[model samples]
Target: MICNVFTQSIKRKYLVLAFVLVCGLTIMVSYYKPISHRYMFLPDTQVANLNFYDQNVISGFVFGKGTPMAVSCPLLLSGNKQEMLVAQSFKRTTRIPSFYYSYLAKNCSLFKSRRNYITSSLTLEEEQFPIAYSMVVYKDVEQVERLLRSIYRPQNIYCVHLDNKSEPEFRETLTEITNCFQNVFVSKESLDVRWGTMSVLEADLICMHELWKYKSWKYFINLTGQEFPLKTNAEIVGILKNLNGKNNIRKSVLNRWATRWEKAGKAPAGIIPVKGDLQIAVNREFVDYVLHNKTAKKFLKWCSKTKVPDETFFVSLHYNKHLKIGGSYTDDQGNSTDPPYITRFKTWEGTAKPCHGKYVRRVCVYGVGDLPLLINRKELFVNKLHLDFEPLALDCLEETLYNVTRNEYFQTLEGNGPPKHT
Candidate 1:
């Protein structure tokens, strides 16, 4: 009997050990599994259902295997011409009404789950050095939601300013989306933001004031709803870290619009008026100075009365040396030839390299053909992708970004070096 009892105890110990090893192996496999496989088991939802395109094709395009011959190349190059044609046909025929977003935002948990937002910080550096975004949006709730998801990071903060002219349903749906995330909120003030108008600058300022309350953010990037990020959050953080507190705003010689400001006597004295694109990447100190400094406040007031104030206000302040603004560079620092602005990439209507996508207001609305150039461009973000024009372009780009983000996260786990983007 004594021998039998000892044998039984030994058997129990062996069984326990076997169970432990199996559990350890299972966990390791689960942890090391690809994100695509993990998501495959998730329930079908708008965000959860990511198998909208062939993984092989997306991977090939993103990794630069099957680049199109030209900007106007047919969708046949993407490896799914029929599907692209069908999607394009559907988008052209159907209109996604505003209520669609209202329904999607109804259940916050399911909404987030389906959207598959990266709820945790991917890296220590990204978490510690948070970035602030001010998104000014008016139409296309679907595109707006996709853009938010593509750039969403829990560590960062976002303040969305809707055009006052936007429909009431649009505002409600946007608020619903923002409410789902603790870090994102809709701006209390809304403006009827007309193109090239002071309202555009005012809308940005409203968010700037709101975003300033969050003291932890390192940089501020303003984006429109139509824009999408070319780089992942980690990549953007890496680039911004390299800036060493210098602002990224393109400075051009004063345009014909400057004469209007001068003739109206609204241009600030002792301040040379300069013009630039409205999209900017500025540091927190610059934002604070723009909000609190006396000269900046006066310039803002003067800009309010001037035409296309949004294009001139920030660049003028950044180019002026006397302001001593953090990250400010003066005209003497290579202002004659405008250095490339890496913040945003946009193709105008009549460039030597014509827009492959249709032009809306002389700006390219990126189509499926433009993916080759877009994927290879070194800019942080690409401007103007419309869902109605070519849903496949946005779809393929979103999938590409998803793959890049997943690869980046796994690369971090393997102790690989950081992502390098020129």
Candidate 2:
């Protein structure tokens, strides 16, 4: 009877072991199972991961009917010691600026020192294209200063448009900051920018007109104060050179919602209305035509009466055949073809929403976990970075873009054969 009991106990042990192994296998399979399969194309995302799917297939697996296929997965970062340090620095800077700006304003030398510390670390590259930038900013003075530092190059020019509605202290701080940099200037004509109004377009138009005075800039890129450059100025110069005079603008269909301007009797005939975001990069010739051409002026006037002229003005200018500049690459449908759309990376409302960061007013505020994704992206600039939401994101970008150690990282990628320039 004792022997029988021992055999039964041994059998029970084996049964328990088998059950644990089966449970482990089940858990592993569940972890990796395809959560969902859906079409994705993140035109505004930092990385355009569209190479995986073909535009001709219908299976949506090995084949798909899309220009590019992008399947997004969850992204999360493990907070390391260094990342925490950067986060701490961001907190300190954001807090102290508000409290100390009054005293700093009275003391010029101290103010200069603080400004120098941020700008001095950046090293501009040689043989770089003279890029022109117009950044429209309202609040977030500290954030804008950080962005300027990251993208500052002696060769390029910057036009900053501070909203006329901004507080006096914000205006004073921006003036003091720009006073130190010769290439940087505060737009003399500051517009009171509003959502869904022509004023937004007017602010950019004012900057473009100002930037046009200097004939040296090769390409005109627009920015809001929240954007930061992912690629160095040197890398961007290489991209523009290869483009050979092509512009990067996002194109979209103008449906009923887009036709609001037309319904309101703001759109004009002989001008085909297209839709795109205000963020874009255009050549000097394009800028001149938009500012001076009679046709463009009439279109502008009509658009000013529209709901959101910013979206219509540039798209119309780009596709307008009357301009006689065949700069825009049109598809078979006669729309702008796979334009590089690289001036700024953004996350909009859709299936591929950013799972790794917080969203404010329906826009993703990128964080450190999103760094790997941003770095891998082909775009030169990424936008809407608020220090309050994700300080480490900007901090890591500074460390990677400006720090000496980054040279090695760049060298390796180049040595391994850098991806074709965007």
Candidate 3:
């Protein structure tokens, strides 16, 4: 009887140990899963195994069209009014903190596994001709990370300039994330970027200086944290190749305040100050000229004393034929009308189609309703997505891009053809 009692006690102990092990696993799973996944409507099992390259998984859940279509579609894309309301009610409950990135950095393989960062050049053209990006970011670390991930290509180089006034945690998280990539780095010199100020131009200059070290890059594109790409890397390379050597700098009619530069005597003599967008896609030669040319240096220095120097500096250099900056537009284009450029697509308040998303500071913060238009835009990138206001907008855009990229990559591998560049 004593022997039988001992045997029963052993079985009881084994059951208790098994229960503890199961509880431990549940806790670990909850703790390790990213907060972003919690907002996804997919079942935990499907989301846990989600893979962009898996055709079976992507065709169903990723594209939002499969069995149980209502649940499969991203909440924002659902036609049901109730689902739309549910998405509207969903808010980012927590900021992705520094520790999260720190953990990822420690486990680099796990970091790469969690997100679909294209680690290889998908095409020969992309590998042969790499692009450089300058990102000036201040707030919204999560948005910054997502933007980086969406545009990330191993062949490309990235220089991120963080605002000096940003939170320490923001800096820490960015540093950790950038540390994972060889080509990506945070600018050593941080500036306090303010709107309508020379600091904006200065931030880009700092990145340009650093990016100049990467001799292999063919073109330089400046971006902000809120923007996301509309084209894949291969598509972007094809477009840049078509440009041959010309720059894509938007030139607009001079602002009424242009006289202020002349009044202050800050304008270089005989050099006309013009207004244009801060975002630009200039060739390596243009970037080199801006970094080292004596005339460009003088123009930039003079611009410092003027209001909103960013709106004038690059455009002025490109328009002034006398400067002879490589890849610049020699003709006086922006004296009367805004010249067209395909570098970025932004919806300003009171212009073009009505903003489906709400306006903040006169810029449209894109919502899910804007996805159709965004997908159709030919611009390389689209500007200003607010994670808090409409996270699904970004989520859907990102998923679509991922699927497109995967399909293009596989098609090329099958000897079909290169990605079609519009």
Candidate 4:
């Protein structure tokens, strides 16, 4: 009787173990559902529900260029009509719930976790050509992400400045994206950015101050979230190197007389006031001058009370003969200042009426129609590309840039020459 009782106890333990294993396997299978039939990666020939074949309508939220982007999509709730409907609605209208972020966070490991960047180029040699960026964005997470991806390189440092007045969700989304990459970070100080106000300059200055601690960076460029690079990272780095230590801040031809600036009581004695669209790319020495120079500090204080300080501040600082950083102070041979000014392509609403899209705040929203003009221009970057307004333009531009880079890289591998000119 004792032997029979022991045999039954052993049988019960085996049965319990089998049940536990079955349950664990079921949970694992349920957690990782198959990707949706309607989903496919971009630039592929497959026709998913995303309309990937539609060259004009495909979304620009692609995760990979040449790298593999592992994506997981869940359509398990499809059997439930109500849940499916809600999910579809969100995907169409807001895209707030999608597999994009999962892939972005997991497979896109191009970013470095520390200041020490590692380069893995197959053709080009590993070199430290770190560029610092100050990108001030208030909204449009999709566009911002697109811009960041298009310009992202492991060697560069990016400081994102979010407006204090932005919605909580918007701020959180940006923070989450930036947190995934160590090279990209939210500025320690955020300002309530007001249009045509000094707050814009202040926000950029805060980012500049933070980036200054990394003395290895060679150049700094300020951008809004709406901008996209026309040149590849290698091309941009080459351009900066050719600058040979000069700054590229656009000097305004609008302000002519010293009296006009004097009337505002902001112009320093014997300092000429200048204006530009306010985008600037400068060398480390130029940044140092603006940050530590007593005159530049006084100029900043004076511009605080002036109208549209961003338009005038950087240009004025760059052109200051006392600073001797910009082309104005250099020789006229043009060799000292290659491809003068911060050449960013921006179309004003008053002039270019946006052939394919609407104007936002007197600035043309570039579209597919503007591609010829934009591509032919000698600008390093183009401004005011909103995904909601003209997604195709960004897509086409990205494709063009990718092809150019790929061709150049492959040519280098074939013993042709270094990647340049595209």
Top TM-score: which candidate number?
3
For candidate 1, lDDT tens digit of each residue in 1-422?
Answer: 99999999999999999999799768855754333343233345533223332233233344233432122223433535564455445453333344544544656776676456778888887898899999999988878988998899999999999999998878888998899889999999989999877888989999999999999999999999999998989999998888878889986663565564864474664787788889999999899998999889899888877778888899889888787887878558555433357899999787775466799999999877677778878789999898878766776677678777778888888999558754
> Each model's TM-score?
0.78, 0.70, 0.81, 0.73
**Could you tell me how far off, in angstroms, the CA of residue 412 lies in candidate 3 after the best superposition?**
0.6
lDDT per residue (tens digit) for residues 1-422 in model 2: 99999999999999999999798767845654332222112243312221221111111211111211121111212445464445434442223243233334344455555443333222332324688999999987767876786677667899999999999878987887777667889998988999889899999999998888987788999999878888866577767777778877775654665555756564564776777778888888788878998877888888877778788788777766555654664453645344567777888756474635667777777876677777666787887687777565765565455532245335545664232454
The TM-score that candidate 2 achieves is: 0.70
lDDT of 4 by residue, 336-406 (tens): 43456545877776663344445788777775556656666677898878776545466567656665666
Residue 408, candidate 1: how far off, in angstroms? 0.5
Q: Model 2: runs farther than 4 Å from truth?
A: 1-128, 264-266, 330-338, 404-422
Steric clashes per prediction: 1, 0, 0, 0
lDDT for position 415 in model 2: 67
lDDT of each: 0.78, 0.66, 0.78, 0.66
True-vs-predicted CA distance for residue 50, candidate 1, Å: 13
In Å, residue 8's CA in model 3 sits off its true spot by 17
Candidate 1 lDDT at 382 equals: 92
Model 1: ten consecutive residues of lowest lDDT: 67-76
283-377, model 3: which lDDT tens digit per residue?
Answer: 98899889998878888888887878898899888877787777888765546232358899999898877678899999999887777678778
* Per-candidate RMSD, Å: 12.5, 19.9, 6.1, 10.5
